[model samples]
Target: MQHLDLDFVRQQFPMFQTELGQKIGFLDNAGGSYVAGAVIDRLTDFYTNYKVQPYGANPISNRAGEAMELGRRTMAELLNVSADLITLGASSTQCFNTLSIACTPLVAKGRSAAAGEVIVSEQDHESNIGGWERLCQQQGATLKIWPVDPESGELALEDLEKLLSNKTAIVAVTHSSNIIGTINPINEIAALVHGVNAKLVVDGVSYAPHAWPNLDVLDADAYVFSTYKTYGTHLGVMVVREDFLQELAPQCHFFNMPYPNKRLDSAGPDHAAIAALAGIGDYFAALHDHHFAGKKGLPLHRKARAVAALMNQHENELCAYLLENLNDLPVRIFGRKTIEQREANIALSSPKISSKALADGLAEYDIAAKNGHFYAYRLLQAMGVADMNDGVLRISLSHYNSLEEVERCVAGLRAMLG
Candidate 1:
């Protein structure tokens, strides 16, 4: 509310001033946030100082190894989960791929023949949905689809309830709609999936940047998100429930001891980026401290709640300005009409201008916007916007964006739309 310490926060990101020769305004934070200074410093430190295989006798290797362990705990704290249950990987796709493979053993040796199916909603990104589809194909398991609402850009839980049966071994869903900006009811979805004795997996790639997740309270068997989207370096983080971790087979070696967290990570990661995620923990904790200065009793949920409240309030104002100005301009909003009803990502199609042409035009004015489906195919198809594969011109906001900038953006768009 106090304008987010503009100089201090902006200083944390050196790229903001230098990118596009200092004139570009970043409106694509939902795609990926600019890395903060703490993350950059941590990444550089990993390369120059602790760049070695961890846990070896060498002093540097031990520190590198320690850095990795510390990073795990930091990630755990960030997600409000146990450190022992966290698995780090290269990307959300890779992590989900490895996870699906690990679940193969369970489906293969199912206690009941019916316990081999996995259910997925059509609106999820290719990252989570594609891997499961391939896994189901190979395992001779049934892949069930849950319908999404076309008009509201929302998932239909009643459809999901009808699809669930004893055969459903796992249920995977996106925590948010990247294309339409709808925040799905993941907690309720998790409850329904788990009630049917199925493991609930969540794709948080779009949700995690704007929300600080509470893994223990969220009730998902496993959660996945990308560090880059969260303003950290590039890496994939998976938080698996301790009990569910036991069901996953090892990915590394046949003789590898069964550890819940280690077994699911299939590939070796870039130590620099994986370690840089530690900075995000530092960033969140610092923000919490700033928001709750002199207050120590607040737990993770409260701190996260405060931060989210500020962000939502800030982002809503931006989206309201954009939507109000864009009204009657021959543009059709891709999601709900107001940001309060959805996240602050405004995706719109223009009858007068090609989406890409408008995106480029905005770029020429030093306004950074994007035009694409954002990989939410089912949302596009349901909304009947699939023909515009480059469906909408997108402007996604974050807490750091200012009210003045929103006005500037609306002014620019009005001129461009004219």
Candidate 2:
């Protein structure tokens, strides 16, 4: 396999050319990534040419509608699902709230002698956990916990299997933990959840940037991720299996129930943001072409997989280097000890200094790092970090980050600690 060209990859993102980018070492990619130039161009083009209401017979309206549809189709192709199965919302938090409400009736239907059960991981962001927990509370259902291992920061499949029961209506988990950065065995979890006749909902927001999830391989009932985190516009893209889509009660108006895709999104769609999401396809295609020149005739999903493979390899290298340096320090690192089982989103705490102080010091070296629970409040509490205000220092990296940057981050930390 060909290695990713760092120079070419950096060129695609206009942020690196900006003054702040030129000075600061941006390691907080897990929070969000720099938007690609292609996405920006698409957004601009939409506003310039098709700034009217979509889906009408009028020329501008038709073009606007077509652009929005193209974005949905391209994103669906990236995830290996049908365009109608994809729903674009304001954000993943909003989408899950809408989804949980829609799925409430389904859970109510499954309720019998025992309260209809909903199992959620302590390892997930609040965006994933809160909505489901609230839904369970509202319907007087039993809410179960699939707890994570506090020490290793990993979730066990055996624990998940024990939680599954015939009354289980939904099992919500993360494709990868944002704080821990360990990639959970989603397919295995999906199988266990499905065997018990429960639908699986996954939060792919953290994992999507590192590697695009193939919903076909995952077999989740529904998967959610934000486009902003995946080098595109600011929108949350959700993929609901057709079977489950029809089962959930519509959150949209009565007229939209006929259209399964529109049923989940209650708010007015952001026409420009939706249209710009198609640029993600363009960005991936460009990456594929740059790395695998003259290799044509590959489908969009295939090309995405090819790009993801290279990106993951490069990210693993950065993760290993960062872990090696941290291992030598007195800091307590979260997640798997090996790079093979984790993404580049690393969280750690130093015994000598507070998380905030360390992060502040790193800033002095022009490194952009963050310190907080990062919305993984429940997980932090479970890990014995009672105080959310003083959370772990996070150094999240992306494929665009170079080995040189990793070395610089390590040096920054060492200087601060010493």
Candidate 3:
């Protein structure tokens, strides 16, 4: 019930100060979020004190290993898992690739016609789909799709059930779509997939920013997200069920390997940035203390709930304002019509309006956003906007964006169309 202290929250992010000389209106949050001060501090501190090899006899190296340990503990708590199950990587895509490799030998050897299958949604970000798709293509495994409904941008459970069978190996989907902004019922999907003896893998890159996931709630086997999207360092974190880790094959150098966690991070690790991810957790703790007002118990969840609530409210208002302004214009707005009814993303299209031209036009008036498929190529194709090679103009928002910024964007859009 507490209101957001926009001023205080904005201060935590240095980029809000117009560091780029001009007022940079960043609506490209779906691509990557701006880093917070606490995250930056951790990155700086790590580079200063422990920029050396880890797990060595030297003091700096020992601290380097310890720093990574802190990150493991911190992210585990944030994602609600044991530290042993947590693995840090360069990006979500890379980690999933490693995961895909680790899961290879487990795929059915085709002794019978009902060979194992991996169920991937057509709506998944390329990172989620490509790794698994390529795995199926090369491994002689079958790949089944939970296709997003072309009109609604949603995948129905019944459709998924029809596609699933005892041959199911894995069911991978996004917690939320980066394009259409629809939140998948991951918990329900997991139940359905698990009934068929398959594991669930969730891509939380978009959801992590707006909600706190209780890994237990979904009963998923593997989950992944990019820390950069969570107000933290530029890193990706993956949590695999301990059972899954043990069953999977090694993915990295054998002599240098420690555990399944190590085998999964092919790039070794970015100790400094990983430590910075812990700092982001510290920042969240501070925010919880400051924003919870009178709440008690489960501080992390309280903070997560408060932040997500505020963001949802603010983003809805912004989307409403933007949609209202564009209503009479030639633009064909995509996704849900009601702002509060949708996730914090808005896409506008026109019969012949070039998304690039609209984006470039907005840039001239001091607005920033993206034009094109945005790696949500399949979603665009489903929405029938794929032909707009430039795609629809996208305005993605986070909690930090303001009502004033919304007005500025509206004005810019109006001017461009005029």
Best by lDDT: 2
Off-target runs (Cα >4 Å) in candidate 1 are 1-3, 19-21, 108-115, 296-305, 386-389
lDDT of 3 by residue, 138-202 (tens): 77898888888887677789999999998888888999887777778887888898898888899
lDDT of 2 at 54: 95
Better of 2 and 3 by lDDT: 2
Error of model 3, residue 82, in angstroms = 0.8
Error of 1 at 173 (Å): 1.0
Clashing pairs in 2: none
lDDT of 3 at 80: 63
Query: What 10-residue stretch in candidate 1 is worst by lDDT?
Result: 1-10
* Residue-level error in angstroms, candidate 3, position 376: 1.6
TM-score of each candidate?
A: 0.92, 0.97, 0.92
Q: Rate the local accuracy (lDDT) of all candidates.
A: 0.77, 0.89, 0.78
Q: How many pairs in model 1 have backbone atoms within 3 A of each other, for residues 3 or more apart or on separate chains, i.e. clashes?
A: 1
How far residue 52's Cα lies from its native spot in candidate 1, in Å, is: 2.1
State the RMSD for candidate 2.
Answer: 1.4
lDDT of candidate 2 over 1-418, digit per residue (tens):
5899999999999999999987788899998999999999999999999989899999999999999988888998888888888888999999999999999766774346666799999999999989988998788788899898888767989998888888888999999999989888888888898998889999999999998897778889999999999898889988999999888989888988888788897795689999998899999999999888887568889899999999999999999988988988888888876697788899999877999998898888788899999999999888877568989999999999988878888998998776
Candidate 2, residue 308: CA error in Å?
0.9
